[model samples]
Target: MEASSNFLKRSGFLTLLMIFVLCCSKEVNIPEPVQAYEPHTSKIREILFIGNSFTSFNLGISYHLNLYLANDSLSYKPLIQEAAFSGYSLAVHLTNEQTLAKLNERSWDVIILQENTDIAVNDTMATLESIKAFQELVGNKGTLIYLLMSWPYKDQPEMLIPIIKTFEEGSQAIGATIIPVGEVWTAINQDGNPNIDLYNADGMHPSLQGTFLAASMCYSHIYNQNPSENPYLAGLENTTALYLKQKAN
Candidate 1:
């Protein structure tokens, strides 16, 4: 009887030991999500920015783009290449040496041009002249895209609505693409989501969420991604990729 009891205890201990060993052997740990990336060259040859405080946006939009480039795990990081700044219009920046330096530095891959939200008002000619003058300096190889920055005027979308055609005209004339963030915001605003705050304290500049939306849109277009479906723009990417591919052929 004692031998039988000893055998049972020994078996039980072995079973427990096997369980412990199995537990220690390995755990099916899911890998962490890989850091975001794009299939672009390691060095960002050049990029230039011209726009309003909206384009500058507490500089959040620009910084977020840089962050996306810097954090990418690929061997090559997307560098700034070059940058220029102006408020409200391109007129000031185009005249400045900084704009020339940025343009002259390299055959830029992209040039970001943005106009003030109130282009329907005064000094729009100044904005247009800047774009025209800068285009002369902007080398032929780079793709220019007009950033259609959205206003945070959640209450008065009407005041902000007229700028759409202005952006489209800029895009058509300059052979540039439009970011169309205003369209995105207009659609979102129409949904009447009470939970989302689209504007900053002044009710003009986008808040963080608005910035995220803009950044996501920029990210989507630049990387050939979509913003809505894939959660952080997974679905949008494929659609753009396919579209670009089809267009190329």
Candidate 2:
């Protein structure tokens, strides 16, 4: 009987030990499987900006474009250069020696043409002719040509209508893509009196916010992605940047 009792105690102790071991195993923290590290496949694209002060102001649209590309996780690394002259029209660029030189400098993957706001609105035919000429310069090199539709003067809100019409007409005529930046500006302005002004003091050129918004639109159109996803603020307040992105989208 004593031997039987000893066996029972031993069995109980072993069972307790097994239960304790199982309980400890359940409490043990197992690490999750590590994901494989995948490197970004880097691609460099040469982009040329041919426009006026609207494209060059606030350190140029290309500058902000590069910033967005650099900050984003995308594989594209932009080699951006601009031939921007203040208050110059696309017609003037067609004749300018520097502009001609830049066109021949290299084969650009993309060329963005931003016409002077006044010229685009007032001389629509002239703007269309210049766009055609620029396209000819780009040649059949498979270079994607895009028109950067600029915004109207802050006080002269009526300019937006003609500007949009001109750009849309030019895009159809020249087979170039329209960035529709002016439309985005108009939408934001009409939505409400936004906290961030889209115009500079001259009520013509873009403010920093305006430039950022333009850049966001460019990035969205070119990359075929949502600009709101990009984290680069371009020195604007977070909320302002977000507003511009959402509006651009």
Quick one: best TM-score, which candidate? 2
Candidate 2 wrong stretches, greater than 4 Å: 1-44, 73-77
Model 2 poorest 10 in a row by lDDT: 35-44
Against the hidden reference, what TM-scores do the models get?
0.66, 0.84
Q: Report the error of model 2 at residue 125, Å.
A: 0.6
Candidate 1, residue 14: Cα displacement in angstroms equals 26
Residue-by-residue lDDT tens digits, candidate 2, 23-63: 98887677999975332333438889999888999999899
Kindly list the per-residue Cα lDDT of model 1 for residues 15-95, writing each as its tens digit. 999999999898788899987544344344345555656666645566665654454444664544324343445665666
Give candidate 1's root-mean-square deviation (CA, Å): 8.4
